[model samples]
Target: MATAPTASNLPLFYKDLVPLSSVDHADFHARPLDSADFLINQHAVPLTSDEFVSASRHYPIVFSAGDNPVPLALMGLNEGINTFVSEEGKLINPVYVPAYIRRYPFMLARLRPDTDELSLCFDPTSGAIGKFDEGDVLFVDGKPSDAVNNILEFCKNFEEAGQRTGQFVEELQKADLLMDGEVSIQADGYEQPFVYRGFKMVDETKLRELRGDVLRKMMQNGILALIFAHLFSLQLMREIFAEQVKAGKMPAVTVAPTTA
Candidate 1:
């Protein structure tokens, strides 16, 4: 087994990155939920500049399930959360676009929202990142593992539907291109709900630069530091769970409590 990480093993092993804070909680919502719903109602709402700063100041890491707050990771960078702080610490809204989606073939073309202006969208049905528009109907696929499959299917369905309606054009097909980057087979499947620490949001330009830098450093590091940290924290939770099992303090695999 890999040695458990400690303060001494860190920053160096992780390329000098350290978590801003840590949480002692052992609970993780292992059953994957609808990411689209979590992103919209829990994530997109109440993300004002004031709330970001206030929450960040109170805790170096801020987590949310929709609008609910939670804890940070023990180490490394966590998920990318919308931010209200710049590198200089000024309050500003941070727009988020995952590197995979940004570089993915469809996201760059057919998947991109018509407007360059940043907005939040929760769509498990789309393989590409999407921006929300008023009155555009959305469907939720609650099964997490099926999320990506649904997205791929949606694209195929969309193309077929467009053709049936005479909306398909050869020129539009030209716009469909995937980023040269590959999505890891390991990355397949729905992600369970969990805590993220030190998620900072930035503008689209800044996000692009940061993501590029992170991607460049990914192989050098196991995972990007932020994502690595979150993964590490999840592993740590497993460790905690294992220890608890040994002590009979908890069951081997405890399902998350639906309430509180």
Candidate 2:
């Protein structure tokens, strides 16, 4: 169960959102994505179901803690630390970028809770959007321009992917396959290892005990493969931890007893 995203839960760098409208933003335009420095501080980026395979190749996909468990790509061991991003805001490695990050500055959000309708919105502070004389126009002839239409299409696809991700998470929860997640790393010259917890992972024991019909269904639906991808990606936790050490950002505390 993924937690409902609130304004607080919205990704970093998104601030002062206003619904995009032809009437209000007739002259709005967007510049090219010139830099990725904004993503430097994000240690984990949300992952949609469609991203599992490619994301698994680059990042350790793990479920966030709590009743609502959104899949997250671990970029760093600790919060506000993205080791993959260099000082210049460029990605340090050639890893698959999560759509959540790629779709930034533009998001489909429900302006009100009573209605299910979503509105196209953007971060006014993002600097990528403005009333620029050059760049992709957001509106033309009192209607959305091609750029705006494309952004809407992307948002629509993201919403659909989010729905699929939710269903996948629901299946995992229904089968009670989730267990508390933990990881430990012992960096060189460090006597005690650093331990990380407060996440969830598939319980292999529970998964193996699933009924034949359920297992078969999961396999047929490709959920089983996704599960394995998640499991396999856990091995990257050590790699991420090592990167943190190399960056001189290792945690100060020593390992403690594993927590659930």
Candidate 3:
């Protein structure tokens, strides 16, 4: 979820934020971009529960270790190595690109601490928006253009989905279903297996032992499918490790995963 914007703690990929204004940015336009150089060294991205189904197909959906854990999509098992994306940030293959990635440069954020209202903001350093000669215009006749409107709508939907995701995680925590996660990948001719940790996952035993009524409620509310999606995606952890080894980015026999 997009959170408060500040000088010291800008979110991943954002260098600075400025609220979009029709008067100030009347001539600014957005250009098409096919790459994200910012994601080069990032191993994990914030994922919403709504993305569990699609993201589960490409990345292992797991929880961060903390009191208020959020879902994350693991792009790689080792540090600074993303298997699906190239070193330059062009996606290496066709995969489910996360909305968090797609929403780059544009996100809903509160502009002031005194107000509860959120404003449309963009990372000015991205270079994706400017007074470009070609590409989508941000404003027309002092009103937001269709392209800008679409971006706002997408950001709004992302924030809404974040709320639902928080509720789902709260349920998991209340049920005591999350546990520290561990995975060991043994490469050929190696005596010791590579151990990866620093993440959390659902406790399958606890999930199976949930009361029937609770399970029924989860199913009725679509939480059951999301949980299963996360559980099923964990199998991809080894696949990611193999990819890291193939790319020569794997650590020496054993190593822990990057906590970030």
Ranking of models by TM-score: 3, 2, 1
lDDT of 3 at 36: 82
Q: Across residues 70-162, which tens digit of lDDT does each residue of candidate 1 receive?
A: 222211112122132333423233433222222122211222458653211222233222333422222223322344344445545534443
lDDT for each candidate structure: 0.27, 0.84, 0.86
- For 60-148, candidate 3 gives per-residue lDDT tens digits of 98888756788989888765677888977799888998999999999999988999899999999898998889889999999999999
lDDT of 2 by residue, 1-260 (tens): 12235457665567668899888888888997777877787777789988999999888898988878889888877766788998788888788989998888999999999999999999888888898888998888998988889999999999999999999999999999998887877778877777888679999899989999999999999999999999999999888888888898876565422212
The worst-scoring run of ten residues by lDDT in candidate 1 lies at 177-186
Off by over 4 Å in 2: 1-12, 255-260
Per-prediction TM-score to the true structure, in the order listed: 0.20, 0.92, 0.95
Cα-based RMSD of the predictions, in order? Answer: 22.2, 2.8, 2.5
- Sort by lDDT, best first: what order? 3, 2, 1
Kindly indicate the candidate among 1 and 2 with the higher lDDT. Answer: 2
